[model samples]
Target: MLRVLSLLLVVQLCVAQQLEWPKQYTAKGQIILPYGDIVEPFTAYVDMSGKGRSRIDYYGGSAIVLNLGDEGQYGAMFKIVYETTQDFANVMTCFAVPGASGAPVTPQGVLPDISMYKYAADYMYNDVMSEIYISNNAEEEKNNNYTLLVRKDNKNPILFRFVGLDRLFGSHYDEYVIEYSDFETTVDATVFDYAKKFTCKGFPGPGLTLAMTENPMFEFVGAGEYEEKHRSYKVDSDFEEFKGHHSRQYDDEGEEAKRKTHFRHNHRYIHSMNRRDLPYKLRVNHLTDLADGEISRMRGYRHTPDSPRDTLYKPSISDVPEYYNWRLRGAVTPVKDQGICGSCWSFGTVGTLEGSQFIKNGMKNLKAFSEQSLMDCSWGYGNNGCDGGESERAYSWIMENGCIPTEESYGGGRYLMQDGFCNVNKSECGAKISMYMNTLPGNVTSLVMAIAERGPISVAIDASHKSFSFYSHGVYYEPACGNGADDLDHQVLAVGYGTLTPGDPDSEYWYIKNSWSTHWGNDGYVLMSRKNNNCGVATDASFAILN
Candidate 1:
């Protein structure tokens, strides 16, 4: 009886030792398959910030990064097979597929749960001995067990290895390993920062759907709750004062001020992520307005001398189906992120080319053309490089140059995010645009028909409102945003259109493809108010011709 009691006491002590584990550390190792192949070598950097917030990144694209917060939890996985380099972060900066689809097989259970194991060990590595443990089912998979090693002193797992038959494949035994090293009690705060670089098309999780403030304007209800919730976020002492200032200005100036107002201009009840930390001037609108001189320079149509103009031939199309998405048609291209560069012109230009080529040549031959070529080379023909640019100028450059290189070939498959000397090698060109047609300014019918017939149409819109910066979803319609041709500042692609209600014409909205990455909106697209040229979306619609 005494011997049995001693064993129980020892087991209790073992579990107690693992109660407080090292939350911030990095583990590096490789996976050895049954065939003795060492594959998917990786280094996982982890940050568990004690508030149920944790981020894990594996060196290779095999691991998916998890970003969780109170606002909206997002998680996605992608394997960047093409980019194999030392910089894992850059590889993660690319878009990831859904976790279910991504690899290294997202197990139902993760490593570090070592309670199921019964044995322990003191393994020697780098001339130092560390105590560890073992488990037959580290991930609770049938025919799977792991050798778990714990820190010599802390009792936290320092090395973990699962050796068992592959339950999922049922073909061979598998070996997974993780060796924790270079332990640190605390990590840099930036380690937990949600990177806008990596993204998924739609919201990984769900909450409130985005909507514009129209007749049924959303009323701010949780004022006290809003103020209390934001107190935790780092802000200046005068944040309350700033809120007060906007509140007074909004209430005092009557309806005119309300019409021309922004997010904080009327309501302070907003997601903390939506708040901008910029100075008042920069925050007034979400974007910088174009100079009058720049507008004048870009307004004129610059067509290729020998190219034929596109004649508008509309089919007497009836509103057939309740809803339509261009992605279903398979012509839409993979959304490209422009990074920090304001070269929306390049993205818009590239999107036009991708869609046109896919529509003309079919899906198998689709290619992602080079935006860098236009960014670096089109400066002489009126593009501003990283500063900003116009789509018309990009089209004109395409017409003159015959074509640009594929993104894979250009710059050796990387976006510089800065201007570089243009590579004018004709052999690198992957696709060519014969001509481009600009639709009548403020013509919704023409833009709709054009998109239905062709594919995505390059457009310029007024994305100056602060709400636009953090727009998630909805038919964004802000009448105060103005409806002038000159209001267009940001260039994007109109991939398709849809209706919220099946047969309601008033429910129509355009599906806008943005360059700000898939995490920004409904998987990198937005539904803007349709039929009225809301936000001046139809002000300048154009598409490429890949003949």
Candidate 2:
């Protein structure tokens, strides 16, 4: 009997050492994956009140904001998950029943209880170590070696570090850690309020749709308490705002209704995206109303295989700048619109040639090189003109012809939508390149070197997603971006690189100039997530070697 009593007492004492956290608190740190890889750093906001609410912004990566419903609400819950990078955020709001799919998208959207409360549950208090006094400074984490933590009140833990398995590691037996900080007691009520009350009007009700995102309009969605009253107010007000912003007028009432449906979709998506408070914003721009096929046709890039010599240049960059922009040096030309043409390759090709010429002449504007020259004349070299083409073929055509002509020298252009007869004078010469160099697949270091030390590099990226089309500002990044030749469908120039936050490697970005006009992006440029080549910025990138 005495032995049993002693064991019970010891267990109770062990449990007593647990750290009691506030109902609402926030933490920021890195997510070291179980496979010994560190993902983009993240800022997590967790609230365990009435219904648990949490928000996580993973640097320039994806973000998650969800609300766990209470019993009184009949287990109603809502979640919005975005597959994003620093450049752009692509969202999927499918709420299939929990066990329907094993993928991240299939996770139970509605749960019986607030799972966030489990962070401080009974089982998490084991081996809390001794109580120690420490100030809220950098020295504390190093002095204690992340063994234990005690906050200002000396009651609960301020520097709480949870080292656990990503299980995710499976047989490898690896572990990941979340060192939590910035503890608080009160959660901002306004955080998830808008989403919790969202009606998702003009769209289907939130349900388990057994597929990837079926529509782009539902990008920023969080299923709220199903209500009918919100329909009239939310949809009507948003429609008016959309009309005023874009100054739109319909031919008839039916057409207005149809446009309203698209407006509602984009309005809801834009609202949800802004609510995330991520660096980037999605605007109801010109591409917003365009059909999906139209948007796809706009991204014209025909993939060409890199020759053996292209693979020879391995990245050997030792030191790179924290920030660099070719635009600041006047190496970049003013943004031009591609219109409805699939001439992105020609634009990127011309951009690099123009930059090389500027650099070779010591920042002297020789002449504006003609993309139409490449579009019309490079057809025999396997370029499809405005229909679609590869930068490699265009470069080859330039090399074969020995030089490229200025826009005026080539008799201007035959508009962006079509190609004209090859009018190369054969003797025409403006911008010239001795040869071009290529960067290895996904080798971002070489990309930086080529851009900083040489000139702008023509790069291909997977920008087919609607999120990229509607991007207004902020670093564009999405995890779904692939680096394969087939995956890359849009051509752009990597003109510079920079960091949004110092000391954070994930905050780095690549400044890419696009040919989508000054009205698109931040005056026709996008800051792509750097370091990781998030959108295949380095894959098949070519630099003009001007003599």
Candidate 3:
């Protein structure tokens, strides 16, 4: 009984020792692993966790000890586990050494070089060691078989290399695998050095063999108090040599200049008024008279406000009209040019009225409306010639005083005086007028849906002169673009929405037809953001239902 108890005590002591935590140590200058060697060692600090017991963690990964020594050096070993049968296929290992102050040294060679070809031979580099290797696992693979050794002097800096596992194999899709094990050999310095080496065995299949040899001799370096040295190396090679295959010159200055130019041009045309002979107030009053009249015609309907400003409403994909098969042929027309005129309001109002007419009359022909008639004739609602106006007001004017053809009542012709009589062909302008009324104060989605279901609807937006230019993206609000909220003067037609791709829940983007020429974005049809503030679209109508 006494002998048995003693033996049990001995066994318990051995187990306890094996499970004990390794001592912490400061890293010395460098650690090295020679070529063709399987194992190397270095020193490192260990931190354990838990209430009573803990585990080692380095760079956020759990660490285990493979070897321990009091002399302050450590050893690590790596082996290839798998290789590919395909030619030119290989695998390789790489090491990431910590720079001074514990930052990682940038990996040296072009990542993913040829050594990554075969499966078994590729597993040679241990990133923790800042070294890599390529080697063959099979004798039949001897043609490409090779081995790499790495070592670091006590004061020397680390280096990197690519060891050919035989000759280069030219192919893609080759495979390789490797495994690495690390251990701490000594304790003293805060600095740790890691090293790795690789050996290759030939191709996979029968006749595969590996040579058995004694482990290579390794030296143990002692730890001592030394001043920390922080040094960095600069590449002597030309930067052009390192340029990626896809690299290109980016002209940031040119891009900025173009953007500025676009903004400037749009700003001037939209806001600035250049009066040739007529007074500024006269021009503005004429445009305002037309705009107010148009808006008054649509005042009978209930105007609803958008509830949630940010939420976007999209029409169901199935309900959207097909592009080629759409039946509202006359509703969609080419964008018109409002040349050097503050008459955007008139153009927008008339264009929308035309679409509405088509929807109400079931007519397939689109009749061009006379903007000059409204600019010159409308007294209370719109501004004068070449001056700004409101679109909704223009519609009200048209409803009250019916519009004639441009031939019968021509515009003051490009900075010229407004002729009271029609100068163009009056027969072409006699299209029947139509109107639609809104039942609720609808948001952008509801307005568009009403158009899609009922017919084209006339809507007002803040079209201050500043906002006349083309905008690629982003929301337009007052104060930011100098367009006041009350500047809701422009009129437009909401024709349809662009197609939505799968996964886009709110794909119902508004397709607004602008009075600006087709040279504008997407052929004068701006894609308005459907997410908020009704995308600046406000709907009001006079005719609730056409008789």
**Counted clashes in each candidate structure:** 7, 11, 99
Predicted candidate 3 versus true structure: per-residue lDDT over 1-547, tens digit per residue: 0011011111111111111222332222211222111112322343211111111122122111111122122212212221222242223322211123232111111012232322111112233232223333432322333222222212111222222232223221111111113334344233222212434333221110100000011101101111012110001011122222213233674443333323222222221121001011111111121222232332221112331121122333335342221124667556666644556556655665666555666666565557667666554643444545554455455555554343223443331323244343333443433333542343644555555664555555654432234343222222332122443545566665543333443433556676555645455566554444343564332121222
lDDT minimum window of 10 residues, candidate 2: 1-10
Give the C-alpha miss distance for residue 249 in model 1, angstroms: 36
Compared with the true structure, the alpha-carbon lDDT of candidate 2 equals 0.59
TM-score, candidate number 2: 0.57
TM-score, candidate number 1: 0.47
lDDT of each: 0.53, 0.59, 0.33
- Top lDDT: which candidate number? 2
Q: Output the number of the TM-score-best candidate.
A: 2
Every model: Cα RMSD to truth: 24.4, 17.6, 26.0
Error of 3 at 246 (Å): 34
Q: What would the TM-scores of all predictions be?
A: 0.47, 0.57, 0.37
Report the lDDT tens digits of candidate 1 across residue range 1-547: 0001011113321442343445565545543322211233444445544322334443343333443322233333322212223332123233333322111112111245444555543566445555555554333333755555555665545555545554544533333344555455554556445444445344323212111110001111111222224322222222344445444333453332223222232222122212212111112222112222322332222223342335343435644343456666776677766756677878887887788888777655767788888888887677777777777788778778888688888777677777887876733777877777877768887777777776788888887654566466545776567657667778888888877666766658888888776645667778888757878888778887675
Put down candidate 2 lDDT per residue, 292-378, tens digits, no spaces.
666788688987554323334545566767678888989888888887889999989888888888888888774578888888888
